[model samples]
Target: MVLPTLDKPVGQCLTNLRRPGGLGKDPERAQRRAEQLAAVDPDWNPGALGWTVDWQRHYTGLTLLLEGGAGLEEIVPGVTHRGDDIGRWLARQRRDWARLNTEQQHRLGEMGVKPVARPQKTATRTNTKTGATKGSDAFTRGVAALQQYIAREGTTVVSRSHVERLPDGTEHRTGVWAANQRARRDKLDAAQLSMLAALGLEWAA
Candidate 1:
């Protein structure tokens, strides 16, 4: 906890942004929960601020991911400068809105953009060019896994779970993976079991 300052009243409660107690849970997880609820709620509007590709004349726009915030965000799809957002994503791409021809539409679609509407349950989170994401099979099968672990345990310097150890006593994850999820999963599974048999990947070893 940070120390109380002189300007702040003594004994008054202060909201800690770091811990998320007063700020509420992280928006990503909260959004996932809200969608899960909507799936079960009969009264929920099918158009109830769920994820959609907002076409504001198309040419100079970006995809918006409307999720949890002060209000519904999924209405936008991907975040773009012209659209409304609670705040910009921590990570972002730089685009030149001026470079785009707002009035015209491409017949064969641009490099990183898709024309079809996105669906919820299997909404693909990817990098259009590389098809990559935070935990893409190539990046880390372990991002959400690690984040979920963090949400439960809070802050700590050391961590456990799914850490792979190679020879030479170096403990770390090392490998590339197939582009397909099914193939990637099978590879990871086999690798992990083999590592276990070889006396690596053991939590206590």
Candidate 2:
């Protein structure tokens, strides 16, 4: 801090400032002691005292950012050191959670009653072990046989269930029976069918 000057008040002031015990001065012994202390911090000059405190403040801020107090927020419950409520935070949490082992996620789901992925239900058709294929009823076969017989015999016989609404109206036969029935209800009188079977044919449904 001292500057050379002419022999005057300025000269005296400069001499005082340049003395070894001046405010910015260090003697040989003090310099050696400071060097010993600051050798452990090779990047710094121990003579610059302000650098130490400024460096400490910077380190504290960095630590705070990593210890959940500054910068961003981490919305992932207990998983991160940051505290950012970004738009994708929840989605990120879900992805991270899913990255855990299967058993771990399973345990979490069990704890929270979360629904696990399930196999999708499929459209299934039963494989019948026996009997006719679909759209073919026992009664249908019987009616077909009856129709063939009537066509051969050239005669009309009444079905007990059908005795009204004569379609032929030639004082002819009457019925609500359809000529082209694709579906049939398979019902037969068991006792009557048994009697018919005892005499001859089997009437089955």
Candidate 3:
């Protein structure tokens, strides 16, 4: 059986459904519930709302009653729902809707409710370019080496070039030009830094 399509945007559809004596028939309560649900859902969409064919069949008689209220009596066709069956389905819908927290409910808002996309879980990152892996024995050793190096030679001291004057008063020899140069000369470079990072270790600047 062909189920009716809901071309109206979700928000509008919900607004209509939640109005007093409206389609869903729950009134102001429905709108407040819808808003609460939307606020909690980061990926909430204002489109795509409707009841499934199965639901329509299950609530066929009730749907007929509700459709009359909403002027949509002809949407579902040829489903014979008993009065007892309709009463049971309506009770279930009420119970289910009442149980919703709007914060915790995933997709049970109404028929045709689609779940918003959940953020993807990221895997532990590996940097092959620098050969860095967290919690590895190698990484741990690298951090230890860095700590030892730092302890032996405190913070990087800016090495000033030693200006030597020749017999003629001309500069003869000069020391390292920059502190970074001194660091490199002392064997502290990107390799050590990468290792420290991999082991989640922080070094004093």
| Top candidate by TM-score | 1
lDDT (Cα, tens digit) per residue for candidate 1, span 20-130 = 433356777756655664576532221122111121212222333222232322324344445432122211111112222332124113423333343455555445535
CA lDDT of each candidate? 0.30, 0.34, 0.38
Candidate 2, 1-205: lDDT as tens digits = 3333544574345333323453244577666655664575542331132112222223333344445444323323333223222212222223345323455345435434233354676755566523433434433444444433332222234353543322233221222332222122144344323322221122221
Candidate 3 local lDDT, 114-173, one digit each (tens): 333445767655565244343344434433433332322232222355433433444422
User: Candidate 2, TM-score vs. the true structure?
Assistant: 0.17
Candidate 3: segments with Cα more than 4 A from true spot: 1-52, 66-84, 98-205
Residue-pair clash count for candidate 1: 8
Clashes of each: 8, 6, 0
Q: Order of candidates by TM-score, top first?
A: 1, 3, 2
TM-scores for the candidates? 0.19, 0.17, 0.18
Ranking by lDDT: 3, 2, 1
- Candidate 3 lDDT at 120 equals 77
lDDT of 2 at 187: 44
